[model samples]
Target: MLTQLTISNFAIVKQLELDWRNGMTTITGETGAGKSIAIDALGLCLGDRAVTNVVRPNTKKADLSATFDIKKNKPANTWLSQHDLEGDDECILRRVISSEGRSKAYINGSPVPLTQLKELGRLLINIHGQHDHQLIVKASEQRRLLDNYAKHQNLIDDVSYYAKKWAELTNELERLQTSQAQREAEQQLLQYQVKELDEFSICEGEFETLENDYKKFSNSQSILEDTLTTLELACDNEQFNILDSLRQCVDRLIQYSDIDGDLANVSTIYQDALIQLEDASNDLRHFHERLELDPQQFQVIEERYSNAINLARKHQVSPESLHIKHQELLQALANISGDDSRQEQIFVELDKTKIDYLEAAKRLSDSRSKAAGEISQLITSSIQELNMPHGQFKAHVSTKEGEQLSSHGLDDITFLVSINPGQALEAMHKVASGGELSRISLAMQVILADKVTSPALIFDEVDVGISGPTASMVGDKLKQLAKTTQVICVTHLPQVACKGHQQYFVAKLTDGEHTETTVTELSEQARVKEIARLLAGDKISEHSLANASELLAS
Candidate 1:
């Protein structure tokens, strides 16, 4: 159950700390007094969207936090343990919204995504909004309510899981089954490509070797000329050649070798350089002798290289990578041929998944049918208590065994109602008036209270448009609801305000420059005044106070 709420700089609230208790707590204020602001703050902490301007004016950020004692909330505690967010006995959910419109959520003290906060919040509290009845028109909402009443989420989940598996299997089968013509065409094209690469039979690294040899033979004349010129400069020159100059320097240095130590080192360096130059000149002459210009060989090698280049270009592969691409094409052809066997396997999977989905969906349908009968009777009795004595309510779960499977299983649930004694049962949206719908929505909540998992339930003006005895009945139901769980109700009716275990009064205060909302837990006398203020005008009177006291006493 929720134990504490702290709100700061949120909307018109400057700062507020509220402690909650286990039982029905009524929050009453005049219209537009911001009675729902605390609820809004709680919603934000529960991971509701943080819209722009949510922060108090001139404030950089808004902070909201809620503390829950999960000692009795096993589901919430289990979730915490699963996420490794467990504490001694408390869980804190917090939301911070910057003035720049960025928001962050935290579990305990660790940051989390908004989705995780919302998921955990669902287990901690259930908020029944004022306009929840408006959603009765939606078929999905109707189905969800019935499922909630059924308390068979495992069945629903199984159905969903099986349905997803079915979809996946069917999709795979279709991918392999559809486009048969295209698949065959692709196979044929791959076969032709493989044949062409096989016939070409270009060996690995063959293209580079062929290209190098062709270039060497084509440029053989220039190669020989350059070789001859280098040899002439180094050793073949008739006079003033580099080799001769080095030889003279060696002899000259040897003469002064004993005269100076540095001169002796120079003599050794000159001698080594001369020997190296002679060796290089001999190697160059040998290379010139071995070189041969074979135009015919060059022409043959050039033709082979050009074909290799053309083949690589045709296949869109580098000449060096052509072999790799050939192997890839071969693998592709093998995979294409194996598709028939793979397709057969997928067909078998589809059949198995279809059977699984049908079984799960059938179980869900049975559960829904049983839950529908049970909840319908409860809702009908509760609606009569809310001043609809002649009203007849039915939760009809129609199962389509012959139709296709859906995520929600084979059931289509409809909330049927007959507001008049002899009227035929019909959908709530088409039959119930706004007042009737509100009462019905309330009755559903009252009946489904114990069926829910949340330990705390908040009702935000769900009794709007209801007054007098109906409002009194609404309050009685809420008070009864608190016997099993904590209930927080924001209401305007004095009848409802008088039925609280604790009462808080909301009011707007302003001095012309700044406006703010404040909530005060009322004392016995203050409670009476606030209830009286709700009954009559803002001006309290003896008669109204007496009436308020009478209501509270009852």
Candidate 2:
């Protein structure tokens, strides 16, 4: 429910602040007292288009704002959370229109796009006025209202689920059908590549290891010769090799061992040296023998390395990556083969899904039609009490074969009205007068209040052209409506004013030479005075005041 409104620099309203109550509130004043300006300001905050002409004279900008209490509005809370805005049961919406035709919108002091503000505004209030009743003539609005009353949650859910499934399955079918030839062609290429790679039977790290081994074998002769020379210098078999010469010297020294003890110890060291030289000579011979290399084997290894590198370059990959490429090609071939089978399945599923969607949609349509009949009867029943004794009301539901299904399902609905008996029940646009439309609109609203979740409803002169008992009925209905949702009405009917939980009088005053709009909340006595003024025009006679008090007391 709207808790407050502030307007500044708007046409004819310099600055006005209004604190609203939770129930029915009535605003009444003399002609041209800027009552409509307040509504316009609220519309601007709700993201209505604005013109520079709406700005006050000599003012650069005009601003309007409204605050709403949201504890009871779960939809609004969810919407705020979805938009990443603060949602603590209170929301403030503000719009500023500049003389230069620039406008800015804010929600809870955070900047927001105009569309977002409009979306949020819709959840808070439904503003119905004389002109807005033309919406009753629209088929879409009638359909929406019927569905809202039908409360077909299960049917709605089923339709939504099947519709989504149909969309997804159909998309898959199209993609597979359109790409079938391409996928087959790709399969051919993938199969060929996979076969070619399998024929090579390449091994991981084989190229690098083989290349290193080949390098070593190619230089085997030089390596072996160097090893032989080093071994021979340490110990060799030819030229007394060190071992035979050392052995003879040690034997000669041993013969004189008895003549010199120190010489005997030297002979033992020479013997040990002879044994080490013989071991080195055997190692030298083994090294020379192992140096043998095959020229043909070296050439084969080189050719194989070249082939691997060439293949790597041709495929734009390293030799080591060939194994990965092989696996990828095989996988691609598998995917291509599966595409045909999956495509057929998807097509079958699409047909089935769409059939299911249409079936659910049909149920929803049937249910809506049934509910629309009952709702029309209820509305018709309310109209007579609203002083339209002869008025005829009808909810027309039409279904054309080719009509598109929307989130709300597939049916065209239009409300028809006949102001008097024997008159044709034409479209609402054709027969509803300003006052009659307001009552009709009010009747529908009253009937549908329990179904609609909006927390606040604003009616702009809904009592226009109505007086007497009918006006009193409208007031009484608004008062009853206040029990559920907040209701505000801009009215000239003193009877309506008398039924309000609160009354505000809008007045125009001049301070020096500047005119400004002012609003004053009426006390009990003052309300009677205002209601009396509304009853007797400019003169407040004792009889009118007494009548006003009696009306208030009642």
State every prediction's TM-score relative to the real structure.
Answer: 0.81, 0.68
Q: Candidate 2: where are CA atoms >4 Å away?
A: 8-13, 30-33, 40-65, 69-124, 178-336, 396-407, 423-427, 430-434, 463-469, 508-515, 524-554
Which has the greatest TM-score?
Answer: 1
| lDDT digits (tens) for residues 461-510 of candidate 1 | 99988998999999999999999899999998998989999999998999
RMSD of each: 4.2, 9.7
lDDT: worst 10-residue window of model 1: 398-407
Instruction: Point out the worst 10-residue segment of candidate 2 by lDDT.
Output: 400-409
| Residue pairs with clashing backbones, model 2 | none
Q: Which candidate is the best by lDDT?
A: 1
Q: How much lDDT does each candidate structure score?
A: 0.90, 0.83
